[model samples]
Target chain A: MIELKNIKKSFDGLEVLKGISMTFEPGKTNLIIGQSGSGKTVLLKCMLGLYSVDSGSMLFGNRPLENMDDNQRRILRREIGMVFQGSALFDSMTVLENVMFPMQMLTDQDEKSIRAAAHEVIDRVNLNEATQKLPAELSGGMQKRVAIARAVVMRPKYLFCDEPNSGLDPKTAIVIDNLIREITKEYNITTVINSHDMNSVMEIGDTILFLKDGLKAWEGNKKQIFKTDNEAINNFVYSSRLMKKVKEVYQ
Target chain B: MKLLHHIGAYLLMLRLVFIKPTKAKVMRKLIFKDIQDLIVGSLGIVAFLSFFVGGVVAIQTALNIESPLIPKSLVGFATRQSVILEFAPTFMCIILAGKVGSFITSSIGTMRVTEQIDALEVMGINSVNYLVFPKLVAMMLLPLVINISMFLGILGGYTATLYGGFSSSADFIDGIQMDFKPFHVFYAFIKTVVFAIVLATIPAYQGYYMKGGALEVGKAATVAFVWTSIVIIVLNYMITQLLLA
Candidate 1:
């Protein structure tokens, strides 16, 4: 589990995360949803230690991340798995090599074992045929699969994905979402996803933290979202006519 | 003030790059690949430029020494001096600042814009050491290339002198043998080593710290080239003053 207490972050004096606090539970898909500039990405980055919080405590399990020394922080980082928004697979490596990279860098495992582990995760993502292909040779959706495979091959304790379904088609988006949710459950990993996609919110958001203007505008599950009385949450969630009509009928 | 900040940051980055590799086998593989990319890939152009420039230096030296007092052997002597002292080491590095430097900047800048560096950081890898240190190791073999350039350059001068009727083969050979100071070769090697470090690190600094997208990658390459050239020229003057002046 990861916990943030009164986390604040700013860039060039423009505060992005304003005293926000949240706890992400293990074995559940924790989703951060907000408008563009609502500090969703910033909050995710702060948790990933990509951005340092201005004044707050970030606890990974029981240990505060900021208090750890450099070496200790790096040791902790090896336990993390992140899927970048752009699917940042190493361009020089094929899919198999990309997936095997973390093991090669951090483990004393033999080559055969590493290859086996990579193959297992590649199969899990249903990308066995694409293992020999370079990232550029694959489609955007395929590349995201490769990224996810690479992130999970090490069996990380924490999984973070930033905009995993942004450019994907609807069907592919849900497939990726369900895949992540399944992985989170199978490994019992603490998973955090930053997304603005409503489909993802409804499909796999076991818990959703909604931010508006750097503040927590609302927080709830998918079912709770539709039934919430908060006007701001209602305005944002029912912005589409179809969603508004569904809400009208349901209410 | 900005310059001081860059210098400070560059020095700090160097400290990170010089750390022990997290995995020796991976580092060895990266170093060998860099040798192919940074050193071996540069051979053809280095040879081509060295030969042609050596020939031009010989021809120009022959044409200018019309004074009856100056010996024909002076053409070969002048060519040897220019090639060994300035052409092979300093000029070749300036060329590399354009060739290898641009490549380093663009590749690394592309990685930065694409979030590959972030990926490395997220994985607990020191991205600078992972990316830049192998290039530094590969470029340490730069003296091998410079030595080849020296041999080809003098040979090119010999050919030009003999064939262009600039001087007799015997006169040119005598000029080559006259006043041979081994220290000059050592001096050139020293300069090549220093320039190699500069070539590896400066462009890396530009790329690693770069911001923005594809267009900015191109811009960073240009900026890296300009800064590398400026540093090389400055070092050329300073080293010459300290060593030979």
Candidate 2:
């Protein structure tokens, strides 16, 4: 499990995450949903340790992330997996190489075992046919799959996905979302995903945290989300007429 | 003040680059790749420029020595002097600042633009050590290329002087051997090594710190080249002053 206590972050004196306190349980998809410029990405980055929190504490399991020394932090980072919004696969490497990169960097595993491990993840993502191909050769959805394979190949304790469905079509987006949820359950990993896709929030958002203008607007599961009457989240969730109609039927 | 800040940052980057790599195997692969890209890839152009410029120097020197009192051997001597003292080292590096410098910047800048650098960082890799250290290793082999340039340059000078009938082969050979101070070759090589460091690191600094997309990458390459050339020229003066003054 991962926990954040009074997490606050700012850039150039402009506060972005305002005292967010939350618990992300293991074996579930924890989705942080917010509109653009609503601090979702900033909060995700802080939790990823890409940005130092001005005032806060992040606990990965029982260990406080902010208190770990450099070597300790690095060791912990190895146990963490990140799927960037852009998919950030090394364009220079083949699919297999990209998947195997973290293991090669962080472990002394022999090449034979590493290759086998990489193939296992690639097959998991249904990307076995594209093992030798570079990222440029893959479609957007395929690239996201490759990114997912690379991230989880290490069997990390924590998984972070930043807008995994951004450029994907609706059907492909659902495939990626379900894939993440399935992996989270299978590994019992503490997964945190930052997304604005309402479909993702409704489909696989086991737990959702809604943010508005740097503050938590609402917190609940997808089933609970449709019943909530919080103004900010209601406005955000039902901003579209179709979603409003869906809410009307549910209500 | 901005200049001072850049210098300090550049020095700090160097310090970071010397840190122990997380994986020696990965570092070994990167070093070999950089060798192929930065050194081996540059051989053909450096050779071409070295030879043609050497021929041009011989011809120019021969034409200007109209006074019969000045022996024709001066053509060979001047060619050797010009090639070794300035053209092969300084001019060739300036050319590389365009070819190799721009390459380092654009590639790294694109990685930055694409978040590949961030990927490395998130993986707990020291991105500087992973990226710049390989280039530094590859460029340390630069003196090998410069030695080849020096040889081809003299051969070009010999060809131009003998064919143009400006000097006999024997006289030209004798002139080249006239005041051959090994120190001058040593001095040129010292300058070459120093310039190689500038070539590898300045462009890297530009690329690593750059912010923006493809268009900004292009701009950073231009800026890296300009600063690298400036540093190379200034270092050339300083080295020459300290050692050869």
Candidate 3:
């Protein structure tokens, strides 16, 4: 499990994460949702250790991430898997090579075992036919799958996805969402996703942290989120056409 | 102040580049790839420029010695002097700053633009060592290319002087042997090694620290070339003063 206690982050004296606190349990998809400039990405980056928080503590399973030495941080980083908003696969490497990169860099596994491990995840992501294809040759959805395979090939304790469904079509987006949820449950990984896609929030958002203007405005699951009357989250939820129709039916 | 900041940052980057070294297994692969990209890929152009420019120097030197008071062998000696002392080491590197410098800058800058560097970092890899050190190691072999340039340059000088009727083969060969200080060749090579470092690092610094998107990558390449050439020319002057003057 990952826990944040009063997490605050600022850039150039402008505070982005305003002492936000939340618990992300293992074996579930924890979605952080907010509109543009609402600090969801900032919060995610801080948890990822990409940004240093001003005066708050982030506990990754009782180990405070803010105070770790370089060696400790590196060890922790290896246990954390990130799927970037752009999918960020090395364009030069083929699908198999990209999947096998982390293991080759960090593990003592032999080549035969590493190849088998990479193929296992490649199969998990259903990218078996594109093993030799570079990232440029893959479609957007396929690229995301490659990124996912690379991220989870090591069987990380934590998984972070930044807008995993941004450019994918609706059907492909749902597939990616379900894939992440299934992987999270199977591995018992603490999965934190930063997204604005309502479909993702409703489909696989086992837990949701709603941030508004740098503050945690509400906390709940997809089932409970619609029933809440928090004005900020209501604005967010009803801003969607589908949610607007749902609100009309409720009225 | 901004210049001082860049210099400080550049030095810091150099410091970071050698620390927490990437695994030797990975580094060996990276080094070979860089060699393929940086050294083997560059042989043809370096050879072409050296040959043609060496011929030009000989023809120009021959034309200028029009008076009967001068021996025909002086044509060969002057060609040797120009090619060895300046054209092959300094001028050729300046040209390479355009070819190779831009290449290093654009490729790294594109990686930055695409967030590949961040991917390396998130994997607990030292992105600097992973990216720049391989290029640095590959450029250590740069002197080999410079040696070839020097040889092909003199060969071009020999061909031009002999075939252009400016000097006899014997006179030209004799002139090449005239007062040949091994130090001059040593000096040229010393300059090549130093210039090689400048060629590899300055462009890399520009690319690694560059911000903005695809357009900024092209701009950074231009900026890296300009700064690399300027440093190379300045270093050439300083080295010449110390060694030859």
Candidate 4:
């Protein structure tokens, strides 16, 4: 489990995260959802130790992240895997090489063993056929799968996905979301996804934190999300044309 | 205050690059790749410049001298001095600053903007150690090799001049032996080393700090080339005055 307490951050005097705090439980998908410029990504980055918090602290199983030195933070970082929004695969590397990179860097394993481990994860992500392809050669959805494969290839204890379904087709987005959710459940990793996709919320948001203008506006699962009367979240949820139609149907 | 912060970051990056150089094997590969790209790839330019510059110096010196006051072959000595002391080291560095320096800046800057650097950081890898060290070492070592190649290229030009009847081979040898100073070569060698460091560090620093997107990487590369060229020219003048004076 991950716990954040009074987390605050600002860039050039513009406060982005304003004393926001939330918990991300293990064995479930904990989502931080907000619109563009709403501090969801900043909060995620803070949790990952990419940004130093101005005040308060983040605890990974009650271990404060802010006080650790570079080496200690690196070691902690090794236990976490991140899938960036754009599927930040190393373009110079083939898909197989990209997936095998973490193992090659962090482990003293032999080449044969590393290759085998990489292939195993590729297979798990249903990307076995495109192992030799470069990221540029793959479709948008395929690239995301490769990114996912690389992330889980290390079998990290904590997984972070930033807009995993962004720029993907609705069908492919659901597939990616389900894949992430299934992987989280199977590994029982503490998984946090930053997304604006309502489909993802309904499908795999076992725990959700909703943000509006850098503040924690609400917190609940998907089932409770639809039932909540919070005007801020209501405006965000019903702003989507499809959600509005769904609301009308329910009414 | 920002300058101090930048200096602190530079020191941090330098420490990371040197203290644990072999922590990242990929860095070793990158260094070797850069050596091939910079030294091996610049062979044609070195050969062309050395021959043409040597020929031009020989021809110009031959035209000005009257009779036997200076041996017609003393032109070769002047040519050698020009190539070794000024042309080979300085011009070669300028060429490399344009070529390898820009390449490093753009590639690494693109990686930075794209979050590949962050990926390395998140993977418990020192991005500087993995990315900058190899390129720095490669740039430092490869320029000396290119200087040697440039020297041999000047010799090729001497051969061309002698064969074309611009001067006698014996006279050429005699001329070079008369004007050659051990200190001149030493100065060139030291200057090349300094040039290599400046060329590599400036670009790598610019590249490492790049933010934004693909366009920004291009902007960083352009900035690196411009700044490196300016620095090289300014330092060349300063060092030349200091050493030659």
- Native-vs-model 2 lDDT? 0.92
At residue B84, candidate 4 shows an lDDT of: 81
- The residue ranges of model 4 lying beyond 4 angstroms of the native Cα positions read B1-12, B20-26, B64-68, B163-165
Residue-level lDDT tens digits of model 2 in B132-217: 99999999998888888988898899998888888899889988988899999999999999999999999999999999899999
By DockQ, highest first, what's the ranking? 1, 3, 2, 4
State the lDDT at A234 in candidate 4.
Answer: 90
Candidate 3 lDDT tens digits, A1-251: 99999988888989888899999999999999999999988888888888889988999999999889999999999999999989999978999999999999999899999999999999999999999999999999999999999999999999999999999999999999999999999999999999999999999999999999999999999998878889999999899688899878977
**By lDDT, who's the top model here?**
1
TM for every model, in the order presented, reads 0.98, 0.98, 0.98, 0.93
Query: Candidate 1 vs candidate 4: which has greater DockQ?
Result: 1
lDDT of 2 by residue, A1-251 (tens): 99999999889989998999999999999999989999999998888888999998999999998998998889888988999899998988999999999999989999999999999989999998999999999999999999999999999999999999999999999999999999999999999999999999999999999999899889999999888879899899999998989987987
Every prediction's TM-score for the first chain? 0.97, 0.98, 0.98, 0.98
lDDT of 1 by residue, B193-236 (tens): 99999999999999999999999999999999999999999999
Which parts of model 2 have CA positions greater than 4 angstroms off?
none
TM-score of chain A of 4: 0.98
What are the per-residue Cα lDDT tens digits for candidate 3 across B61-151?
Answer: 8889979998878877887888888988898889889988999999999999988888888899999999899999998888889889988
Q: What are the Cα lDDT values of the candidates?
A: 0.94, 0.92, 0.92, 0.84
Q: Provide the global lDDT of candidate 1 against the true structure.
A: 0.94
| Worst 10-residue lDDT window, candidate 2 chain A | A41-50
Fraction of reference contacts reproduced per prediction?
A: 0.94, 0.68, 0.58, 0.48
Candidate 2, residue B210: the lDDT equals 94
